[model samples]
Target: MKRYKSILTVVAIAILGIAAGAGIKVYSILHTKSADILDAIESSIDSGSAQYAELKEQGRFNILIMGEDDVEGSRRSDTVLFATVDIDDKNMRILSLPRDTRVQIPGHGVQKLNHAFAYGGPDLLKATVEKYLGQPILYYVVIDYNSFPAVVDILGGVEINVEKRMRYVDRAGKLDINIQPGLQTMDGKTALHYVRFRKDALGDIGRVHRQQQFIKALLKKVYDPRILPKIPELTAQMMKLFKTDISPALAIQLAGFAQNELGRERIFFSTLHGQAATVNNLSYWIGDTKAANEFLNAPLEMLISGDVAENRNTNNFAGLSLSYSSAADENGNGKASGTEKKPGQVMKKDELLDLVRSMPESIAVLNGSGKAGLSGEIATRLQKIGIEVVMSANAKHFDYKSSNIVYPINAKPEVVETAKILGKLLDIPSSLIRSNNQAFYPSVIIGHDNQKLMSRIDKLIEISTQ
Candidate 1:
């Protein structure tokens, strides 16, 4: 699996080079001979004009970053990223589109997103993505995978914690990856392997998460004080690695704005949520277009405030039979006891049972309620209902207020639907059910609210089974 790194290096180098150039301007004024480099930098900086300001005032500008590879004599984009730069707000939102995402090409019928590049290179891919996203892309950066390693090497490697043992061998592609789990400094080759390892259950979604993590780590390295003095040389070397439509001046201005105004907290990263599917015997990722549009068009505050997650949950569960059954709600009441079911909101007992039976992914029940053996107990209860419980363990922390059913962003539609049914079965509120691309599988995080559910588990099982 081929993966691409984020465009943080491009922005980071621009910011560092501009900062260094600004500092050198004063010294250059005193020494005529030293002014040549400063003059060149100043000329580039002068490229910022009224149009750039107008775009900035409009709140955000979008950039498309693509990484391409040659396979079987055809060029295809392995990575597609949409970067929304909120200049006024001093933040950026990067959404990665999986290569296998099903999309329509201009002259071609519906095909994999990567095929747009193979069909007409970056131009077609850009137009296809813009059409798919319903947003205009103002600039584009295309990086060839061959140059990726050189860029990483220029940064002196990045430190990252390998979450698991990754081992893959592709003799045809001359690729061999064998990386163990632990915190280690990864050089160019190793970093490439780290981002490209997607053989695990999560597949491309897993790779996307690692790419985001790697970007964050790389950004930290770029901002290190020691790197300040080497900006000019690093920028010169790195600039040669990628092809972009962004002007040197505009790149500097944008990066400077980001570096000066944004903090680590302000930068947000997300993947275009979707599900894996097979159409006509060929595997493809079906993107959630509605959710993607809402996310792209949402207000900066909402995006930063974590409202996007809630919005996604709403969109994913819309019109789905993931609601409470006629028997109970979170308060544990039925219509007979004066707890009237909302019109068209009740899921039949049979439907819930069928959903559990058809669930494809095993869930990891985690105890976040600070209760001992709660995960095991819940796992057992889930298994009783025909749901598989693959792992039961303590959560990273134990202060959760309400139980949550967490599924990966790239989970199959059926998996998500089944997760919702599972959530309803456990009396978990829809608000707590979320999609996390970082997760390896659909999981149940048992919270303090689940204590009540524990007492009702037997009754719940009885109701579901009946």
Candidate 2:
């Protein structure tokens, strides 16, 4: 995905639609944007809302934008953040929730809050979040990571200063990536990695900060005059990659609103304050519920009354739900290695092709419910390696009844072997594996680790360009 900054910059350009007096369409954008609102109040804590809670009462508005990269029916929200823009104050505050933060997930009961989205999509995630913070969500925006590269590319590219020297390799999959610490110009792929890396000690929180910083860098790109001619291309790319309840007319109006009320200097960013804690024997990122409430409800009260403060939200276990499945580690013997493991392996294009060729029969690439793509990227890759690739529209949709990534059941040994190669190469245990067979009722799943690989790849590409 594009750096959050560039994406937001494009979003800001699109917001012009919302700002314009675009009539009902504009109103629809206001209505459909799903904000993660507090669903139920906690009995132990005093009930209140976000910094901008007051703004709502005063006729101001706030909206939450969430991005998820679900492949199958499995839903796992990738980016969750609250965007509070005070029209009156002309101040916008962005508070991001760490995906791994522990919290009470609505309806499904408390677990890692990110699972709320995986189990029920955005609506349930919003409800769970609202309940967590004791506030009402106003609106929402959801999209996938695939849309990211095009969006970033459309804007030319984003500029961000690197903080550290970064490098990693995935040999089995024939993958290697690196990034230098310094002022750097990142294309779509590199920008995507900038926002996705969270493997460091800081965890998700660190990732969120990187996201915010990149937004500033991306905004500079948006404000550049050079991007004006690319408007049509950018809009088209966004439509292809994005699916939102926000109306087309409203989008134009938002663009207008941004041009008028929103300003770079006026925006503020923050997150909820808390530390990881264990609740009911389940590990959770515990915050001073009172302080959390104060931080949230207080600023929100101002926003709704028309005021705005700051923002702020993993684990692996198996046999619980498809949403929480961990990658398989250890040897094929099914032993628990207790080491941090990646869910699947990566293989070189050539290596993967050989594995497929060795299979007894030609396999078909199937969409959910057994559909197929005529000339898809996967098929092209296969063909390059001398394997006959067939696109199957009749491919069974097994694993991802709820999410997006579909994992085949009893995956071909060759596929597993290929992934193992990738796992060994990347140094992360390979837990994810897919097959061309239309069988194996697998759950749809997209691993968080893929984001890391994507970043590593972008870094490598960046170095090559240099």
Candidate 3:
């Protein structure tokens, strides 16, 4: 039997449910004593935007339903779908960002937007996305694969209209997720893969359509009155598996209107229209800037509240570590809750530091003893372009090796390309590289656009360089 890989690590899909945990329970118990938490939250930050509050007080309320792909070990959002709910108007908007969609990477320059997560994790991803949209991302939600099964079980089952016969093998074991392409119900595992399968030649766009379909179905499951009492359990599960800036009180308040808002029939779903293009000799999913700006604004301005608006201007961002779910340690035990068991779990200390020292803020070169003076020559070449260098011996353990750099969850394509160059320079064979990891770069070689894109990724880099 062919060994199965952990599907959770690949898709990072999240299920819709309640958010709760020990922290939540303890807080909730204490909250009964006084209105301290709620009061604090209100005073600390504005939950509702002044504009949104004005509209709601005038009987207009809007909510942006965001679905984030928080795979195990990595909290960075993978798939970002905006669901806009206008309570007073009874309309909704669903916008999907193709994971491969190319966008500005803040300080780095221009690159695939998904890399924002791998480079700096969630904070960078959120910032880059928020800036691109030109609106506040009011409420944020995160969910992962492991918690998905429990959520489906909690709700008895979620009905999904499966598109094709899903016969793929995953770490959850073999999934015979076969169903006709029509109205149908799905259990946890089946539904999970149903929303994640991107085998079609269209690549990530195929995944986008599947995600849109699941959201429509999930809203239906959430609204049925029969699932009302299960809210506490769902919330608890959410706390264990998800994180967001959305506070407990606000979350509860939002739940109150969930059914009425989500039950509407008129919902809009569209992926940003764009064509694949190779700029500076590197591939990118480029779209019309004007169209993207227009498409994102109407809903973003409406649903995103005030606190998030204020955060949009700040440099505060959160960090997340991602590894395969089945990754094992030296003793063959699983690495962590979210890590997958995979061989050659590269030591981040030495290799990561090597890359950092060589490139610092930009790309770098690495050399093993076998390569002799090659590292020096490459370092000299990089120096001509104002890049730095770190020798194998002088390099600290903090340096990431080709593997870790290449497979970083949510990492940018440029970083991956950097790894490929080091690999080729050191004469490392392709077979030695593990392609099954979450962040594998198809090739290690670098292109001029890759470097330019990396430069645009992080705004902080520009400030530091200046």
Candidate with maximal lDDT? 1
lDDT-based ranking: 1, 2, 3
Q: Give the number of colliding residue pairs in candidate 2.
A: 114
Ranking by TM-score: 1, 2, 3
Candidate 2 lDDT by residue in tens digits, 176-234: 44767888788888877778766565666666666766666766566555566666576
TM of each candidate vs. truth: 0.58, 0.52, 0.48
Higher TM-score: candidate 2 or 3?
2
Q: Give the lDDT of residue 123 in candidate 1.
A: 84
lDDT of model number 1: 0.64
Better of 1 and 2 by lDDT: 1
Tens digits of lDDT, candidate 1, 97-128: 88889988899989999889888877888889
User: Who is ahead in TM-score, 1 or 2?
Assistant: 1
Distance from true position, residue 252, model 3, in Å?
A: 1.3
Stretch of 10 with least lDDT, candidate 1: 327-336
